[model samples]
Target: MNFLIISKYFYPQNRIASFRINAFAKYIRNAGHSVTVIAEGDHDMDTEWNGCKVSYVKNKIITESYLRDKIKRRKRWTVRRITASLLNRIFLDYNLFWGFRVFKKANKLFKENRYDVVLSSYMPISPHLAALNLQLAGHKFFWIADMRDEMSKHPYFSKKYKSAYIAIYERLFLKNADLVLSVSKPILDDFRKMHSSSNYLEVRNGYDYEEVYDVNFQSKFTMGYIGQFYDKIKPDNWFHAFSELISEGRIPKDSIIKIIGNNMKIKIPDNIINNVFEIESVPHDEAIRISTTEVDVLVMIHPLGRKGVYSGKIFDYLATNKPILALYDPDDVVGDLLRETRAGFTVKESDIEGIKSMILKCYSIWKNREVLPRDWNKIKQCRRFNQTKILLDYLSEHLPNQ
Candidate 1:
C-alpha cells in the first residue's frame, strides 16, 4: 500500500506529532508499503526521509528579504501582523502555511500516481480539510482522520466554542471520514456522541522499543523527566511533593533531577529551580540514552486539568519498567493507565502532603528492588505500528479498498 501522510509536524522537529507520524511511516514502510509525508518545513526544506519521501511548503510573499530584515530589526512589534497576513494567503489552514507547497506537490503527485490511503494527523486541523479537497477531486483513496488531541473540545477552549460551534463542525466533517481515531477513550466518546460512526477507533501513542531495550539503566538516585515542558506543567508542584523528603534528608541534597527536553528554555517558576539538574534537548535516540542512565524513579507530570490530556512520554516511561511517579489529573488518560498497571500512584495535585507520602512510598519500593507488574508484553503487542495495521484492515473491510 502507498500511504500519504499529511501533518504539520514531522521528523527533526521532535514534537509529539512529528514523532508519532514518523513511527507510523517507518512501520508502514518496513511492512513493505510506501509512505510519503507532507508537512511544514523545519530548518531543512526539502529532503527524503529514510525510505519515505517528504516535502515542505511555505508562503513566498512573506519570506522576502526586506520583510525578514524588518522583522529582525523590530521582531517584538511586526511579527504578529506579518505572520497573520502571510499565513492566511499561503495555507488553507492558516497555521499550516509551511505545508502549502508540500500539499500542492502532493496533489500533483497524487494525480500522476494514485495512493492507497491518505492519513492525516491533527494539531492544525488543515490536513483533514486538505484531504477532503483531494478526495473530492475524483481520488478514491481511503481517508483516515487521526486526532491526537480534541479539536475545539480541548479544555483550553472557551466555553462558547466547545458548547456550540465545535459540535456542529466536528459532526459534519468527521461524518465524511472513512475512520476517526483518538488517543484515548474520553475523546472517542465525545466523537461517538455527536457522530454514531462505527468507523471511529482509538489507536494510542506508545513507546519506541529501541529506547527501551538499548540503553543501560545507570543512575542510583537520579530522578528523570523526558518530554517538552511548559507553564501548565508546574515543576514547583513536583518539588513540593518531595519537600518532606528534602527536609527529612531521605533524598540527598545533590541528588539529580534531570529534565531532558527543549522545555529548559521555558520560564519556570523560581520556586522549583533549586531542585533541578538541567540537560539541553537532544535527538530522540540521545534522549532515550540520557533517560535510561537514571537509576532511581521516573516522573511524568502534567497540569491538573480536565481528563484526557496524557503526554506521550507516559507510554515510553511505562516501557522502561522503572518505578513510575505520574502526577496528573485523577481523570486524565495517563492517570487511568497508571491505575490499570497498578505500577504507580496518582495523587491529587493540590494535596501536596499526599504527593509527599507517595514519593516516600515510591522511594521505599525503589530501595526494596520490587518489580511491579508492568504491561510491557501487552504494550509490545498493541503499539502505534500494529495499530496502523489494524486501522488499514478496518478501512479495507468497511470503506472502499480502491
Candidate 2:
C-alpha cells in the first residue's frame, strides 16, 4: 500500500502530534507500506527521514525578531503567558498560506500516484482541508483524519473565543472525511455526537518501550513528572501534598522530585526547590528512559479542565508500570484509564489532603512489597505499536490496495 501522511509537524517537534505521526509512519513503513510524509519545511530542513519519503513546503510567513523573543520570555519571568498567548493567537493568520501550499502539494501527489490512503493529523486542521481538496479533485482515496486534541471543543481555545471560525471549518472538513481517529474514546464520542453518520476510531498516544526500559533505576523513591509545564496546571497542589509528608518526615529529605519539560513558564515553589531536580528538554528516548528507570514513582498531574481532556503522558506512565500517583480531574480521560487498567491511584486535582494520603499510602505499599505492580500485558495493550497494528487492520479492511 502507498500511504501519504499529511501532517503540519513531524519528528523533532517535541509535540504530541509530531511524536504520534513519526511513530505511526515508521510502523506503517515497517508493515510493508510505502509511506510519504508532507510537512512544513520551515527554515533549514531535510527532505527525508528514516525509510519514509518526505516533501517540504515553505511557510508563507516567518517571524524571527527581538520582539518575538520578548514575547516568548515574558511568560517565563512573570505570570504573563496568557497575555503573550493572546497576542500570539492574533498573529496566526499571517501563516495561513503555509497550509494552502502543503494542500496543493498533497493534491498533486494524489493525482500522480495510485495512493491507497491519505492520513492527515490535526491541530492545524489544514491537513483535513487538504485531504478534502484531494477528494474533491476526483481522487477517492480513503481519507483518515486524526485528531490529537479537539479543535473547537478544546478547553483552552473554547474559552478564549479566538478561533471559532477555524473550529467551524474543522468540523465541516472532518464531517466529510472517510474516517476519523482520536486519542481517546470520549473525544471520538464527542465527534460522533457532532457528526452522527461519520465513522470514528480511537488510536491512543502510547509509549515506546525500547526508549524507556534501557535506563538503570537511579534511586528507589524518586517521584517525577515530565512533559510541558503550564501556569494553569502549576504543581502548587502537588507541592502542598508532598509538603505534608516532608514536614512529617515520612518522606526523606534526600528523596528527589524530578521535573522534565518546560518548567521555565511555571515557577516551582521555593519551598520544594532544595529537593527538586530539573533537567532541560531532551530527546524523547532520553526522557522516556528517565521516566521509567530513573524515577521510582511516575506522577500524572493535570489541571482541572473540561471533560475528556487527559494528559498524553498517561499511557507512557502505564508503560513504565511504576506505581502511579495520577493527579487529575475525577471526570477526565486519565481518571477513566486509571479505573480501566487498575494500574494506579487517582486523587482529584483539588483534593490536596486526599493526594497526600494517597502518596503516603503509596510509599507504605512500596516499602512493604517485594516487587512493583508492573503489569506487562496491560501495559503492552496501551502501546503505540499495538494501536498502529489496529489502525493497519482498519486500513486493510476499509482501504485495501485494489
Candidate 3:
C-alpha cells in the first residue's frame, strides 16, 4: 500500500512532530509498505528515505514569505506576536495562503500517482486544509486527519475565537476526514462532543532512539529536565517546595539539578546556585544521553491551563529509564500515564509537601544504591517502534495488505 503523508516538517528538521513522522516512515517502509511525505522546505527537492520518497512543497507567496521572514527574524517565537496585524493579518490570513500553496502542490502530486491512504498531520493545520480541498474536490482516498496535538483547544486563540468558532472548525475538519486521531484522550473528547459521527481515536506520541554518548551517573544526586521552559511550566514552584528542606539542611547544598536546553533563571539562594546547572539548548542526541544516563531523576513540568497538552518529552523521559518527578495536574495526560506505568511519582503543582516527599524518597533510593521500581514491560508499551504496529493495524483495517 502506498501512503501519502502531509506534514509541515520532516526528517532533518528534528521538531516534535518531525520525529514521529520520520520514525513512522522508516518503520512502515521496513514493514513492506511505501511511504511518501509532503513537507515544507526551501526549494523543491526529492529524496529517498529508508526506501520511501519525500517531496518538498515550497511556500513562495508574498504573504507567506513575509510571515516566514518575520517569524525567522523573531526566531520562530509565536509569543512574540503582540499586535492585531500579527494576529489578524499574518497568522489568520497567511495560513490560508499557505493552504492554497499546499493544495496546489498536493493536487499536482495526487494527479501524478494514486495513493491508497492520505494522512494529514497537523500543527499549523494548513496541511489538513489543503488535503480537505482535494478530498472535497472528489479525490478518492481514505483520509485520516492526525492531530499531533489539540487543534480545537489550542491556547493561541483569544476569547473572541476560542470556543464557538474553533469548535465548529474542528467539527468541519473531523467531519470531512474519514478518521481523526489526537495525541491524547482529552483531545479526542473535545472533538467527540461536537462531531459524534466521525471516527475519533487517541494516538500517544512515542520516543525515537538516537545515538548518544556514554556518561556515568555522577555520585552527586542529580535531577535533570532537558526541554524548553515557557509561561505554563512554572519551575519556580518546585524550588519553593524545596525551600524548607534546603534551608533546614536536610537536602544537600551541592546536590545537582540540571535544567538543560532551557534556562528560566530561577532565583535560588546563593547556597544552591553551585548545584543548579542551566545548560542552553543542546542537540537532540546530547540532550537524550544526558537525561538518560547522567541523571538519577528526570523532572517534568506540566502546563497549567492546557488540559490535553501532552508534550512528546513524556515518552522520551520514560524511555530514559530514570524515575520521573512529574509536577503535574491530575487532568493532564501525564498524571494517569505515570500512575499506570509506575515509572515516576506525581505531585500536584501547588503541593509543596508532596513535592518534598517525592524528592526525599528518590534521594533515599539514590543513596542506598537501590533501583527505581519501573515496570520495564509497561514502559516498553510507549516505544516509537511499538507504535508503528498500531498505525499498521489502522492501515490494515482501512486499506487491505497494509
Candidate 4:
C-alpha cells in the first residue's frame, strides 16, 4: 500500500506533534509500504527518512513571521490580541495560507501517484484543511483524518460563537473522512456525537523507541519534566509539594527538580529555587536519553477538567520504563493508564499531601534501587510499531479494494 501523509508537523521538527506521524511513516515504510510525507518547513525541500520520501512546503504569506516580528518589536498586548482574535474569527486558523500551499502540492502529487491512503493529522488544522480541499475537488482515496486533539469542541475555546462557527467546518471534514482517528477514546466519542459516523477509531499515541539505556540515576533523588505547560496545565502544585517535602526533611535538601523545554514563567518558591534547575530545550533524542537514564522520576501534568488529553510526552516517559509521577485528577484516563501499566503513581493536582506521599514513595524506590513491577506486555502494546500495525490492520479490512 502507498500512503501520502499530510501534516504540518513531521520528523526533524523536534516537537511532540511530529512524533506520531513520524513513527507511522517509519513503521509503515518498514512494513514494505511506500510512504510520502508533505510537511511545513522553513524552506521547500525534498528529503528521505527511513526509506520514506518527504516534501517540505514553505508558506507564501508568512503570517507567523509577521506576528513574531510584531511581538519582538514590543507591540501592545491588547492591540495584538484584538487583531489576532479578529483574524481568527475570519480564518479559523492562522495557517490558512500554508494550507493553500499544501493543497496545491498534495493535489499535484495525487495527479501523478496512485495513493492508497491519505492520512492527515491535525493541531494547526492546516493539513486537514488541505486534505479536505483535495476530497472536495473529487480526488478519491481512503481519507484518514487524525485528530491528535479535538477541533470544534476543543477545551481551549473561550468563545462559544467561535466554536459553533468552527463546528460547521468540522462537520464538513468529518462527513468527507472515510475514517476519523483520535488519540483518546473520549475524543473519538465526541467526534462521533458531532458527525453521527461509526467510522471513528482511537489510536492512542505510543512510544517509538524500545532501546532502554542503562539507568544512571542521579545521586540525589531527581524529578524531571519535559515539554511546555499550556492551557490549564501548571506546575504550581507540584512545586508546592516538593517545597513541603524539603521543609519537612522528607527528601534530601540536595534533591533536584529539573525541567526541560519549559519556556513559561514558573512561580517557584524562593526556598526551592536553588534546588530547581530549569534547562533550555534540547533535541528530542537527547531529551529521551535524559528521561530514560538520568532522572529517577518522570513527572507528567494533565490539567483537571480537561477530558481525553494525554500529553504525548507520557508515552515517551512510559518508554523510559521509569517510575512516573503524574499530577492530575486520579480518576482521569492518564491515571487509569498508569494503573493498568503499573508504570507510575497518579495524584490529583490539588491534593498536595497525596503528591508529597507519591513523591516520597518514588524517592524510596530510587534510594533502594528497587525496580517497580511493570506490565511489560501492556507496555509493549503501546509501542509505535504495534500501534502502526493496529492502524494497518484496520485499513486493510476497511479500505476499498483498488
Q: Give the whole-model CA lDDT for all candidates, comma-separated.
A: 0.68, 0.73, 0.74, 0.84
Model 1 scores a C-alpha lDDT of: 0.68
lDDT by residue (tens digit), candidate 2, 145-242: 88888776776565545557656766786678888988888888878877778888888888766424323344456788887666566777888878
TM-score-based ranking: 4, 3, 2, 1
Residue-by-residue lDDT tens digits, candidate 3, 239-317: 7766666777777767788888664435665656677778866767887878877898888887456777668888888
Misplaced by over 4 Å in model 3 are 60-94, 210-216, 263-271
lDDT of 1 by residue, 114-144 (tens): 7988898876666776777787767887788
Error of 2 at 77 (Å): 13
* Weakest 10 consecutive residues of candidate 2 by summed lDDT: 63-72
lDDT for 86 (candidate 4) = 63
- TM-score, model 1 to reference: 0.84
Listed per model in order, the count of residue pairs whose N, CA or C atoms clash below 3 Å is: 2, 0, 0, 0
What TM-score against the true fold does each predicted structure earn? 0.84, 0.87, 0.88, 0.93
Give me the candidate number with maximum lDDT: 4
Two-way lDDT contest, 1 vs 3, winner: 3
Provide the global lDDT of candidate 3 against the true structure.
Answer: 0.74
| Model 1 vs truth, CA RMSD | 4.4
The alpha-carbon lDDT assigned to residue 53 of candidate 1 equals 85
Give the Å error, residue 241, model 2.
Answer: 1.4
